[model samples]
Target chain A: MADSRAPDPTRRSERSRRAIYAAALALVTEVGYARTTVEAIAARAGVGKQTIYRWWPSKGAVLLEAFLDLADQAARAADGGAGLHGIPDTGDLAADLRLVLRATVDEMNDPAFDLPSRALAAEGIVDAELGAEFARKLLEPQLQLYVKRLRAGQEAGDVRRDIDVRVALELLVGPLAHRWLMRTLPLTHAYADAVADLALYGLAPRP
Target chain B: MADSRAPDPTRRSERSRRAIYAAALALVTEVGYARTTVEAIAARAGVGKQTIYRWWPSKGAVLLEAFLDLADQAARAADGGAGLHGIPDTGDLAADLRLVLRATVDEMNDPAFDLPSRALAAEGIVDAELGAEFARKLLEPQLQLYVKRLRAGQEAGDVRRDIDVRVALELLVGPLAHRWLMRTLPLTHAYADAVADLALYGLAPRP
Candidate 1:
């Protein structure tokens, strides 16, 4: 659907881009990253292969952009304009982390995000070059948001100043990613809260 | 090479088993899970297709068992015949945990373990049934070792009694796994020690 406010001239291009993105995501999810071809994506999107070639250099680039676009859409849908880039810093660090993590839990569960992401991530695991590219473009930027939030927490004296925000953010993110990737257990808001609590307070007994 | 010990009747079977394991691991690493076939593993191992079918049900089963056997070999090699079932309980929780995580770091770095495991892990990400089976047979069992160790920590008053050991173990295993799978950073002994320390001590300022 074209945005009503947009000039009529650009709407056709906008529609084509959306169709390509949808097609790329669906093809990758259905057939997986290794098998999904640019030609197939073009066919599925009802566009010429040249149109896709006009934009992206390879299938990997198309899928990466498609995923980023999907994430942006999911983020907007979840929080009404406050998308994936920002974690709400409501002064309560634990509360803020938990809130974002819960949203992540929801996002991870959504089939639209889950299937295509799993396909891409599976490829990334064995294909080092592709994995690194996806990590740079898709993963690290999101993880950096946590780093920013944790740094803010340090300024607010909520998190320890001596701790590395980068590493500490792993403690926050790593467990969730592990569970989600492995399907070891159900990820829930309660799980997010507990992780936040454990991270703030060590697993060892308080003195 | 056959084992020096007699029990002569089964030596041929043992050799074939080892050959199949090696071939399966090598083929998966070279070509990936999808392209790797039972026929290929059999041919590479210099065995008949019937021989493979006689032992394992499918290519997935063969690869799973091969990985398990490889892990067993790695474990035995690491600790002078001590295998995968237990984590050392030195009565010092942090020290013991660090030691185990360090061994894990070493294992993750091994080419023999790294490539095939990555192939399997990548497949697991997209294939739900395969993923669940690996988690049950290979992963969850290993995680339970940490659960056992943490319970001992609780009894010794080293760990907080209120924590869920299952979830707590994720705090131990998750970061290592996430880092290992994502290749986000170097998985070193120092990183393992830091994760251990952070888990034991809360990120908040010490009183």
Candidate 2:
């Protein structure tokens, strides 16, 4: 039976999707990946389990799309809805990098992102198939944004022409991830700025 | 009653300990940390379950010690028995760092170390207390060796004194771990050399 007073079907579907994504993230964060299930996600989202199954084949698929949505939200939030056109290229490589990394440091500190991300990363590390999928779908694309920024720098003569930008980018990102994951030291904007400084100095053209 | 026919008690205990360490590592490698048990470790080692219980408080403790022992063996192998005196500090800081990083690349490639290590690291990431202990006892000391080498480089005028060596060391080690853990790219000696080269250039004295 068609209901004339009902909300738009497309709009209703979109709302349900957002609820499911939020529910999935919260469930994974609170209970961890092993314990999180589609049934629980559906229950928490206040949506029928059939709705989730119709859209996604498995819990992993649902979670992946949920993360994608979260990242999209973070990206939008970070840049005032510039829509992840890639990292800010203000033409000052060092300052631009520092700003982005500082934002990253803040995001890492946010429990909303941190706990769920750790749970996924831990599972990803043990599950090779999931690890590869994670890298391919999520990590590599984000890293490629750095590549774009570096390439832009290279053309502008700010970064060394002779250096491998791929390898060079790691100096900027690797240390931050290491600090965050290993808990070897406090992660802060100061550290992010230092990394940007060190890596930029390293990436400078030969004397 | 003491068994006179037994090989000296101290030697027997040492043998048992070595066997237990090997078994613990192997079991964890094969079955993962969650499935690994004291009884299983004891059975695999051909020692009584009480032996593992007597020496270690938990499976995590046993795995930790097993990892420690493996690291000792790796260190011995890396340096030909001069002991874990830290990274080699040849006068040429760049070459010395490259040598050690290359060795690290090899170790990361070795399945004997890689599989069990991945299992523990996976668990550690989700388990904060265990992660802290692993870092404090295992990871931080190894990183300090980089600090030692960098400090030596600083004194020798090869590295800039103004730089934070602790932060600088991450430039050397972090990229490797990131690539290894994320499987974003191949882990290789060439990558190690590139990291060493870029980081060294970054640590250079200002013009």
Candidate 3:
């Protein structure tokens, strides 16, 4: 007779994957990108070094995946664990943009998200190859959400038809990112509202 | 009689200051923030370690001053050595902004400014105290120039009186910075022109 308590291989693999991601994010935040090593990550994750090597080719790969995972978690949490599939199409472009931006402000302030993301972003500034990869894999996808929402707004006549959605989305996202990274000023809901208003209506006085 | 060949103290001090700035920038780019040291900067500048410490408390201080100096050099060069004291206050706000932003695009593309500034900015992202210091010393001063220009625009009724000049300035500066730092898109003169138009005229259609 065989024992009935054997764990499933798929479940075991997933557990290991989550552990590795946690370890990667934590280690990078604590020691920074330059000093974080695969061996160290493996040790912290309670996995053998070969297991990490088998799954990821380099530390950058591990860190990028970890960040993607963290972002998903943050997004899901913001959307009440329903999963943030896309920007909500409430038909009110201003309200939708403001909602998403406020969520972003909260995420930026969360220490769990803030510290590690800053580490990855900081490394990305100096590391061109890694930066491009993260931009493609992580940053672009996030920006695309705004693009999708803006395009939807244009279709619904909430946004101007002639607006280049891509560049227009930058007006929504860029100021917040600049202020957060540079720490120039507080990133607040009020600030987000101001950006949305300015982007939508503009700064020129109406006749 | 006093020896006429002896170096003037003022001239010697200015020469040493420039040399130290060059040395600090180069070392940070080569070895990164954590590894770049006072001793190394002193050695590269051909000054005693005491000379560096006499002026700066740490590598952070030295690097901040170096960046401010580099920015001054770039600005002076852009203005044909006249020294850039502030943004030009031409009656046409859009035209004046376009001129300054184009110059900024050129500066961002230049390697001498790009590499060292990235090094310092990368460090600031992870190091809070240093980030705040640099923001106060270097970034804020640069931003204040935009603030002054915007205020001028407001007075001239080019910008809406109700708009916050500080926030309005971000719409001008933020997108360029976001594109340049994240490498999300090509930072071009045309792009800057679009941002200025979008910011000034609003993204929505006029009635």
For candidate 1, give the lDDT of residue B120.
Answer: 87
- Candidate with best DockQ: 1
TM-score of each: 0.93, 0.91, 0.94
A21-124: candidate 3 lDDT, tens digit per residue: 99999999999888899999999999999999999998888888899899988877766664557888888888888888888887898898899999999988
Q: Evaluate residue A189 in candidate 3 and report its C-alpha lDDT on the 0 to 100 scale.
A: 92
Poorest lDDT segment (10 consecutive residues) of candidate 1 chain A: A2-11
Q: Give candidate 2 misplaced runs (Cα > 4 Å).
A: A1-6, A78-83, A203-207, B1-6, B78-83, B203-207
Tens digits of per-residue lDDT for model 1 on B1-207?
A: 986887765878999999999999999999988889999999999999999999899998898899999988777666667889699998999999998888888888888888998988888889898899899998898888899999999999999999998998888789898888887888999899988888888777667
What is the C-alpha lDDT profile of model 2 across A1-207, one tens digit per residue?
887886789999999999999999998888878789999999999999999999999999999998877776776665567545688889888898998888778767877777888888887887789989988998888888999999998888788777888778888889988887787788899999989888777532335
Off by over 4 Å in 3: A1-6, B1-6, B79-82
Off by over 4 Å in 1: A1-7, B1-7, B79-81
What order do candidates take by TM-score, descending? 3, 1, 2
Per candidate, the number of residue pairs that clash is: 1, 0, 0
lDDT of 2 at A62: 97
Per-prediction DockQ scores? Answer: 0.75, 0.48, 0.73
